[model samples]
Structures are given as structure tokens and as C-alpha cells.
Target: MSERIYSDYLNEYCKDSSIFLVKESEGRVKNFLNLDQEIPDQYRWRFSDLNSIVKQVRSENTRQGLNKIYWTDQSRNIEAYIIMTWWRGNELVRSCLNGLNRREVIVPAIAARSLLELSTVFLLNANTLEKNFKKIMFPPETIVISTDIENLVAKMIWGTRYQPKDELLTQTNIMTALKKLAKSPGTKDLMPTYDFLCDIAHPSFIGNTSYWSHIEVINPDGSERRLMSRLTDRQYNTEITDKTLWALAWSSTCIYNAFIIMRDAYSGLLKKI
Candidate 1:
């Protein structure tokens, strides 16, 4: 597995429809942003705690070494990719939290979506390494599992860290990654939230029309009803803002957990090796 393209991965691992699960998820995405409900009191506390934890966890970036790593060049390369991946995820969590504080909707949702994607992929790779530490660390030239797994990890890191600004692209099929994330152990509950964030991140109905615009019922002649759409200048409706806050908080928490899990797993595996 020499880091094949998205289509090649799809062709080998997927069935006839590459976008089937993604399409299914799209229909399941809801317009909950328009719900007329107050923010939960517990969510307010959770949001504050999330902010504090994010600030604290962000301070751990300077600790880069594996303390007592003993591995070959290949393992070291993987370690470096994992470290950079963690940094990228941390940056996204901060960006999403900042957007939430500013009451920004679309951009924060976008950032949260990216954060979720990164966290999911990192968890995937980390879990794989944990289960097959010796196999992955001491990979042979022709082992299908090791190469494919390595390339998958590399694809995510490369897409985020190496792509040029002018021709930016992601190597992973986002929906595929998300589906895998949802099905993976300890992450099944995140599917709905991830789908909702996807709805907000894209320029679809809930993402744009319901999020950035409101409807007005105008009765000009008192005999007929006409509906009008008005832009909000990026201002969030009260309920929408609350929902976005929850989303950002939830995504930030997920990323933070991923970072801790990754760091510990990397260190633990290095010591074992």
C-alpha cells in the first residue's frame, strides 16, 4: 500500500456505491438549529468546563519526545506523523471554540466538522496500532495490512499537513471516515452529532438557509400571505447559537480525548518496543 488515491481505496475496499452511506446520512441530518428551546443549564456548565480543559490541554504541546522511544526509522516516521496529527487536531479544536465564543455558526461548524474528522481518523489509526503493535511497527515489505494501515494514516496527515494552499484537497473520503468512526467501538454515539455538523458545515438547507436566514410572513393586503427571506449578517438566532455552542463543546471534548488517547498510546507502545 503505497498511499493510493481515494478512488483506488474505494475501488478496492468499497462496493458499487462509494457515496451510499454518505447519502443515507444526508437524509438523516436534521434541522435542529431552528428548534425553539432554551439552552440546557447542564450544557452551560459543560461548555465552560470544555473551554477550561481546552486551554489546559493546549499547554501540553511542548512535550514532543516519547521519553524513551526505541524504534526503527519507519516507526519514528509514524511517530512524527502522529505528533503532527495531534497538533493539527488541537489547532482545530481551538479554532472551533473561538468561533463558538463569537456566536459564529457556519465557520465554527466547519471547524468542528474538521476536528471531528481528524479525531476519528486518529482514533482509527491509534486503535489499529494498539491492536497490532508489533505487526505495524515491524512491517514487512509485502504485508497488506501494515501498508494499507500506514498509508491510511499517512493520507490523513498528508492531506492536512502537506497539501498546498492553491490546490487544497483531502485524501480521505470524509463520509467513509465518518462512517467508520461511527461504527468503531466507543464512538457509535457520535454519528448523529457528526451528521448534524456535516449538515451545518456544508451549504445545504440547514447549513445555510435555516442557519443564516429567517422567514418573514408578510400580509401586504390582509388577504394573502407571502413569505420573505432575510439574511442575519452572520448573527445567530438565540436557539441556533445555543445549539452551535453545544456542537462546538462536544467536538472540542472529542478531540481532547483523542489527543490524550493518542499521546498515551504512542508513549506506551514506544516503551514496549
Candidate 2:
């Protein structure tokens, strides 16, 4: 096949501002078996199902007949879910940034936790794509295995949030899937960073990453703690503060890495077509 250029698709679909691209996004994520909860306006661009995504994006809204450009059958569900997870995570990160830019008062704990979750979702997407790509391209036993991995990854990704179980995917959890993701040239920082990300997401003592204070108390051993300080009213506003910037940096980098990996994987498949 001739070279397939997917740059435009990547650019339009992979960014954070994409949350603004929809009038509204709603549906029950059947993959997770979660109730069809309505999506709030802030999450207007998120979708967890591949079947619903095509109709909403092209046939339903744009009238652009682009459904065939994406996977359409049960056989390709894994590929579709991988893209959906990454894109959804991308938009989520972007939405948080947009809210920050607007100076909306946000709970840092919530923001930090959300960023941590998005990072994990992206990592999971990468793992899913790597594990199933060959299975996706072949036949018979490959298809069966690919389908199972795809569905399992799908359920694992959403199940983390929805808490429902799919009997088929329950054999192995998402943590296992994450561990199976192939190492990437640039993904070395993923897991180590994720360690700290968890703290920010959970309610651990160190996880309450907001309102820090620092007093350089040299102990009897002459050890000094990190130079941390609480944000004062006189400091550059919360959104621009060092802590907030670090959160944004972590979120954007995680999202971008996921996007690049997802984008490359899809582009490779497109070339095979």
C-alpha cells in the first residue's frame, strides 16, 4: 500500500482543546458495563465506546461520511478502544488545563488526582496497543487472542473507574496489562513517575500535595529537606504557581507521550491497509 498520512487526524483528535469540539458527549460505556451516566458539559467530548464514536463524530454531527476511516466491526474493537482511551484521556487533560487558564477555582487534590489517572490511562493504552497489534493483523488464533486482549484492555481501562466486571476480562487485571506493555525508547520515565502520581491521586499523607511549607531545619546530622514553601497570596496566582505548573507539565507530557505512541501505532496499521 502507498504511504498513509494520518497527521491531520492526529492533530485534530489528539489535542487537549478537543473537549470543546462537541456539543455534548453522552452514552453508557458498554465495555465497562457502567450505567449510562450522562456526561457533564465539562466532559462533553469523552466517549468510551467505539460503536458510538463513529456515528457521533462523522455521521451524526459532521455529516462527513468518515465512519469507514475508522474500525467498524466487532473484530476491530480493540484497536478502536485503544484510540478512544488515549483520546479521551487527552481531552480530559486539556479540559483541566483550560479550566486552569480561566482562573476557575479548582481543588488541587482533584486536579492532581485527575492528572495521575490520565497518565495511567495513557500508559494502559500504550500497553494494549503493543500487546495486540500483531494479533490484530493476523487471523484465526491470532484474532481470538487479539479480540480477547482488546476486550480485556477495554474493560480494564474503564473498569478502573466504573467498578463493573466483565467475566471474560477478569482473568487478568489492568495492572497486569500495564506491566505487559512493551518498553519504548522514551517511556522509561513512565512507571517511576507513576509511583508519585499515585500519591497525588490518593488521600495519602504525602498525597495531599497542596499547601506545602518549608523550614530548612538542619538536623543534628546536617541533613536538609527539600526547599518547599506554601503559596502565599502575594505569590503568582495558584494556577501559575510552581506546584500547579508541575501538575500541568506532568499531565501534558503524559498525554503527549500516549498520543504519540497511539498515533504511531495507528499510522502503522494504516500503512498496512
Candidate 3:
């Protein structure tokens, strides 16, 4: 098989304002998911526009769902399941964008990480559906596992008050899904931003003291040693805020692309069934 040249598809599909292209060898170009340089729009108007694109597609998906039922009992209700997942992803992206606009730090970072994982899973599920269109009785195992984990979490959280059913099973190892996404040609670049978001999302040094106010530590002899974190710094937290906005922008793009992939896959499957 010939190597997939992404520039052609990217140029054809992506908006010039939203994407930055880098020239590769042999006159080819690579898609860089963010702006080439920081635009004057520090409030991220362009990022908000990207979220609008996602929201529009989600609206279309809603109409499609209401138009007809795609998956049947024989198909194990895969269409409803996958489409709802995309809708949920849409809501997550909107919330992340809102948080970004509000200048929230940790919540947007955490939401960006979640959007990245959901976007990658949508791509993976689209691939599986395309390959196994005929013999599939259910969605991919990843989808099933993810749903089970979500249900289990809901049950575990509300089980005491409502006593939800025991639907708990194995959990999803996100690294596994991320590894698969890294192997793909179009999505490999997302890993770096995702890694950065993970660092901020986790309750580690980068997530805690790094974003907090620091006080100069004095040695016993009056010599300054280092800075010790005193409290969370909302006044001058540029690093975390800037990095989180960039990642959230990329996450928005990923969510849009994943929706398109899933939309196409659903269209094809609907034609077949």
C-alpha cells in the first residue's frame, strides 16, 4: 500500500485559519494542529469558533438521530451508543471552551485530557466499524469497556442513595488507546499536547506547586536557597493558562475531526443495514 499523504486531505478539509501547515521534504506539508504563532486574539475567538463547528455538527447529528433509528436489536444498538458518545464529547468540548474563556486552570486541563481521550476513542471506533461492518453484532470492545466503566462509576457514586445495578467490569487503560492513536498517521502529533495536559491534569508537581505562588526560601546564613510554594496563584499564572488554552484548542480540533469520522462511518453503516 502507498503511504498516506495527509496534506492533500488536510488542505481539502481543514480551514486555513484554524490549521498551520509545515513544509516537509519533497514539497509535502504536515498539519500542525494549532496556530503557527500566537495570534492577537488572546481571548481565543478562533478557538471559540472551532467549538461552534463542533456544536453545529452535533446539532446535525441530533437531526439524524431523530430522522430514523440506525441500529436495531440485531445490531445491539451500536448507533445510539456511538452517536450519544459523540454528543457527550460535544458537551465536554463546550464545557472546556467555557472554562477556557472563564480562565479556569485545573478544570480545563482535566477537561482537555478527557476530550483528547474521547476523540481518539471515536477515531478508533470508526476504524473498527469500517473494517467489521458485516459481522459486527455490537460496537467495538473499547466502546463496550468504556460504557461499562462509565456505568460502574455512576453506580459506585450513586449506589448508596439509589442502589444502581452492578454493572462494574474492567476499567479502560487510556495509555493503550493513546498508543494506538500515536500509531496513526493523522493523529500522532496529538500525543505531545495530550501528554502536557496529562501533566497538568494529574495532581503532581506541575499540577500543584508549579501553578501556585512561591516564596523565597532563605538559608540559615541569610543566603537565598530556592522558592517554596505558598498558595495557588491566580494573579500571575500565565504558564498554566497559556498551555491549557493551547491544548484546549487542539482538543477542539480533535473533537471536530473525530465527529466527522464517526459521522461518515455511521452514514456508511446506515446504507449497509
RMSD of each: 16.6, 13.8, 14.1
lDDT of 3 by residue, 81-126 (tens): 4445555665675566556555466786788688777767666655
Model 1 superposed RMSD (Cα): 16.6
lDDT of 1 at 152: 50
| After superposition, candidate 2 runs with Cα above 4 Å error | 1-87, 95-106, 134-145, 156-163, 170-244, 270-273
- Candidate 2, TM-score vs. the true structure? 0.45
Tell me how far the alpha carbon of residue 113 in candidate 1 is from the true structure, in angstroms, after superposition.
Answer: 1.5
Q: How do all models score by TM-score? A: 0.53, 0.45, 0.52
Candidate 3's C-alpha lDDT? 0.49
In model 3, how many backbone clashes occur? 0
- Higher-ranked by lDDT: 1 or 2: 1
User: How far in Å is the alpha carbon of 206 misplaced in model 1?
Assistant: 1.6
- The lDDT for every candidate, in the order shown, is 0.49, 0.43, 0.49
Name the weakest run of 10 consecutive residues (lDDT summed) in model 2.
23-32
Q: After superposition, how far is residue 152 of candidate 3 from its true place, in Å?
A: 18
**Ranking 1 against 2 by TM-score, winner:** 1
Q: Candidate 2, residues 229-260: lDDT per residue as tens digits? A: 44432222232222333444555555556655
Clashing pairs in 1: none
lDDT of 1: 0.49
